[model samples]
Target: MNMPRPLIPQVMTTPPTAFPARIRGPLLKLCLGAGTLGLALHVFAADPAPVPPATTTPAATATAGAAATPAAPKAGAQFDWSKVPPVTAPSRPGMFVIAPSGPGYYSLWDVVTGNERKAPPVSPNAPYALMTNPAFEIDYRYMEKPGYEPDLFDPIKRIHMGEDFLLSFGGSFWYRYMRESDARLTNTSDNYHLIRSRFHADFWYQDKVRIFAEFLDARSFGQALAPAATDVNRTDMLNLFADIKLANIKDGPAYLRVGRQELLYGSQRLISTLDWVNTRRTFQGVKAFWRTPTFDLDAFWVRPMITERNQFDNWDTKQEFFGLWGTYKPMKGHLVDMYFLSLDDNRHRALGRNGILGDSITHTLGGRLAGDYNQFLYELEGMYQFGQYSNQDISAFAVASGAGYHFKGAPMNPQAWLRYDFASGDNNANDGRRNTFNQLFPFGNYYLGWIDRVGRQNIHDFNAQINLHPQPWATFTAQYHRFYLANKQDFLYNAAGAATLRDATGQAGSYVGDEIDFRFNIHVDRHQDILVGYSKLFAGNFLKATAPGVSPDLFYVQYNMRF
Candidate 1:
């Protein structure tokens, strides 16, 4: 009799050498320690005695073995061999089996029945997706199967606590080059190079508790230019959070999390982590999450983390934020979201009757409805704000709507869309009332334009975009935008939440500008990406009247890699 060949495991022989210089030493040490600890735990956690494999009657076993020749099973007596478990070799006194239980080993029944079983599903290759695996592996495909016991610190088949602990680490390095001509409608032309590095780790125990942490380092080198509001943080702690499972609900689960982390909501028009920036935004506080098959809810109380040029950045206690966001799916392809948010800032400045600055407290209520039907998609959202700003009353509102269609069988699989956005502005400067809408923290570049010269405050934007996927890993986008001030008396705000070009006299025309943008994105593989884009803004009457309107142009190229 010929025996089947035993499967050999694949292991990493050397460590990766692509990490940034600053973190290479620490990261390498951490990984080595984790590997050693995992092996030790595996060896000590295994059961001393192995259980015997299932068996059948002697006569049946003999007959099955005799019929297990190369020939197929008999015609009328087909048997379902899948129901028969595989047989294993009896355990030796002190020998251990490192391999897991899988289909490589077969039984006499399997051979006699001549039934082929289906293979297991393959895992995704993406870095983010692979991070969920319990064991760490250089190649994602070689990672251990979901339930395979590495023997790692797990007790005998207990209830919920039988699962082994998990540890994983990953990081990314990104470099970008940017050039701006007539920067921000000014006479100056500026150029710069930016480098960013991030390292993160996740530790989970028994599927009930998780501790995650991430660190970031961002720097710039090149010609002297005005510092960008989003890109200058040197080194900081990005995220450090703990999540604890509370209960197993009807169709989903509930969790409570505390610490500093990222917050993102639908459309990102009101809140987001702002990943495009070199230094992403984070919040410090607590959040409660509950979900079901048809609906999900989140409630959080957090303060935005303030970024400083120094390393020791802290939460801004002066600013307090709280919100409740809920999403419900009424049907297969439709979604509705409702949210209420509040902001209490002792230092918030509001425009007064005579150009004075006063503190502000604002509350916002909003809802969104989105759906996909066939090849068509549509979304609509509206928000209203009311509160007090010093001694003045606050009343503001905003509305956004968009529609798109995908050409399924087209040459390039193109998607074309149109959008319009409007935010209320202060109509009477001397009425002791403020009406300019506040956008809070949002991903401004995603909705507006790549240049991000205008924000979602007292503004009107009309945009059209076309997206094409020429290949499975590449995308191209072209967009055009027309901008105007919702009220001529109000100021023009930029993505940084700062007023860029304003006319105090309210004599400038409402037209802000028109912009054209082109972008290309290429995914080299699961761990690398390349992005390039260009944008040109044609100054309109208002811009020309307030600042140097030389038709500002911007170009950027960025490369990213993950491990």
Candidate 2:
């Protein structure tokens, strides 16, 4: 029963969701763009403008009025943090705000200091303050009936206060609503709605340590329009977690403190917790980070939070997960990573846990490497899994690998990826298959392209994509996907009929099938933006053989903004 959602008959027919209350699109965009432009100009035209000399000696000043401008700093040197100015309080005229008291020591003009100037004072009057503004945004989407496909477009708004102690400590707020056009064949068109909202905040104790947290909520309406469709309007517990980090360590390199946090490895093709769905991937755990001259290493362990929906059916069962990941950048733009991960499944028996009665224990070992060359980014990864056989003696293995290339010029970056997946299971064995893509994590949901050639379960997928950044604040992306059965011989003509493997050879063989998706994102302002998108899906002869008319088509769009 643990199958990919797309493979589930119910999900395939389910319509996509829609956004919340509509808003003025054009006016909203104009306001946001103008705000960003104005802020940029202000930063460039501040009073007492600090302008350094164009050249070191200026070929001996053309006129006596010229002062010896300081030499330009080297390009690849570390940024100086000492020159930061001090903060002042309105109530106490002579008092300085937020004096240095925490982990990392504070200094002004450190970002660009030379032997001549020891360091700048940490005062607002010095130069610039380490601060940020917070913002929020929202979007709503919808579609029509019949095909139950999607037509997505919505509205959004966002805002942010300057990054002062109060604003920074309060975090940020965001809300999004999407009405999907697809739902299973229950004929529940326009009946599914999803509302997501989150409140985030961060607290810094001293300069070296910080605490971050977010409260997320998501609700779904299956068929609120129909009194009989109670199944359509259920609320979901998406995400609720907190995490902290300790940046400067007095004795050790650095100690990373984590509670409930999200982690992403290399390209994420083999290991991702899809956050785009609104639920966002999360795990309750802790981790430590060690940084040395050659590399940085992270190690952590976690367990399910056991929210209402994800609670284990059997409370008596015990489950635990742990992992160790490390990254080494021998040179700039080159990163290599290796990890050992383990997850215990108390819900199902391991493949070979017991001798005669023993089931198999699921285990995965994987590693990846990525590099940036000029404007091109590339990723290479591989993973191997071993454990349990549904019906046979001990013997099962799974392997996965992925590669991608990104084009540089323009915002429309072109990229492609190839993935090969193979695992052990009877052509028809039904063991516990892990859902690698369903997790609620932004790192998991983001893809280089727009196809799920590997739409969950035990299927092989090949995918590719192109990203176009035509407008300065907007991006358009497209993707294609193809699917195939792990083994062709185990296919059957009909589930109801008693036809054996031999009689099913007459069915069409597994082959070409693909899905295309297009998406556009526009930045309305520094704090807000809008998104629009659509997709078309098709299945070739290969999918037709597995089940008649199994492939379905769709289109969707949504707009979002922050205030």
Candidate 3:
């Protein structure tokens, strides 16, 4: 019985395997090389692998005596998803675009979405609650070169947290440290650190009513003079403002907002927040903004606020200001704007160190026009500010204009613009007119040598910029700037006798050599990006004074993340 069972194994049959030794080795090598080459290509080219479009087309059919035909729509203006870009759930109901570099290197453009961009439509019956889209950023940068002292670096961040409603509240904070280099202080290297913060709130009521308020606090710490130590610090240079608005009164559509608010009118060459510095220059008075279907109007009365002492009392007391602004858009791509301003400072004295006046009124009026042609964008803006102050009771004025263009046919979307600035203010040696890229009053010179000298005086500047976008998530830019002083120093004589005043430097019309700035950015993921930039400040007499024997050159790299 045992021998019978063992004989059954002899009849067992084996199945053939799928793998063949003849082709197995070549197939394995082919797949491995393909994967390795694909990885190498990906590593060299930053572009993500292209994605194929997903779409479905209607089927075609043949008729008895007609060529193949497709089905026709039962027309009533149906929605066409194919004509629009694919849309995911929108992140929010507003547009946010941000780019950051080193310190003083940030661009923020945020606007409440209307019907454009297919923003979520307003529904009266929908949920009523506060919804906001907030973002923040921080950057650190440094560069190394021989001879020059290592540049002082600091932290910069922007805070924009607020709910869009009848009213909104939020603010931004900033701090910086400027270390005077081994050389003396010429604007190049100053051993001073500035810390500043601001808070603002805006509210709209009854669909047409509005209110606004803002507060600023700042501190400047560091050695006013080197080699020794002293506690002569400056603190709490506070600025406060408030305003109210009334809209759509009676039968006609009109509105009015009165109080303290920074008047940002037109393109900002004339009146702007001057956001370059930490503490912003705010007006302590009232303003009216009226808008209709075809035209909009903006007018204001303001007083420059510098110190916190009697902050609200001296606001519009010595100087009463007024402005009338209007804009008209008759045709598509065409816009026209004009403004008239008046400064009534009766008890006007000399323009003080902080740009305040004792007595005497001044008047400023200007206008601007902008329009778009086939593929070109053009803008023309000019404003004149005239006022009387000082012992001579002299009159000073300023003018600014600019134009820009875009080349849609360019390989990499390209845009270029040119601007000219001519402004006049205090010319005395007093430390007034904070020379900053962002300033309240209309002063020129955004890119001063290492030091900025366009503050508190007469200045003229010419600037140009070109930008290229080779990819949707990357940009490259080049900018050039030059400046010159227009005011000559007049002799000043004291009652004690002789004279102690002379405009030796600026009198001959000081000049700041042309500066070149080049920068580029690469957006990695959705919330992060990298930036690289270089700046060369040509040496000028004014620059030398701020930093003797110093050639200002800066190179920086930074990574930014937003949330």
Q: Write the per-residue lDDT of candidate 2 for residues 1-563, one digit (tens) a residue.
A: 22111111321232222211111232243235434533433343332222221111000111111112212322442422111111111110000111112222122122124212222111111111101111110111011012221211111111112222111321222333333332221223443444445455444333244455555554455534542211121232222232234443321244544455544443444333333444444455555654433344556545544434432111112444555555554554455666555444444443321222322233456666655456444555555554333233333344444444555442333444444444332342333342221111112113322222233323455666555545323445566656554455333221111222221353565553566666655433323334555554465666554444444433334333222
lDDT assessment of candidate 1: 0.62
lDDT of 2: 0.35
Reference-based lDDT, each prediction: 0.62, 0.35, 0.39
lDDT of 1 at 247: 78
Q: lDDT: which candidate is best?
A: 1
Ranking by lDDT: 1, 3, 2
Query: Model 1, 222-256: lDDT tens per residue?
Result: 84676775677766767777778887655445677
- How does each model score on TM-score? 0.73, 0.56, 0.53
lDDT of 1 at 532: 87
Which portions of model 3 miss their true places by more than 4 Å? 1-188, 191-204, 213-253, 307-316, 345-358, 385-387, 391-397, 409-412, 424-440, 443-451, 455-457, 470-476, 487-510, 518-536, 541-563
Q: Which scores better on lDDT, 1 or 3?
A: 1
How much does each candidate deviate from the true structure in C-alpha RMSD? 19.1, 20.1, 28.7
Q: What tens-digit string does per-residue lDDT give for candidate 3 at 63-147?
A: 0111111123224424321111111111100001111111221111112221121211111110110101111001110111122
Sorted on TM-score, best first, the list reads 1, 2, 3
Q: Can you give the lDDT of residue 252 in candidate 2?
A: 22
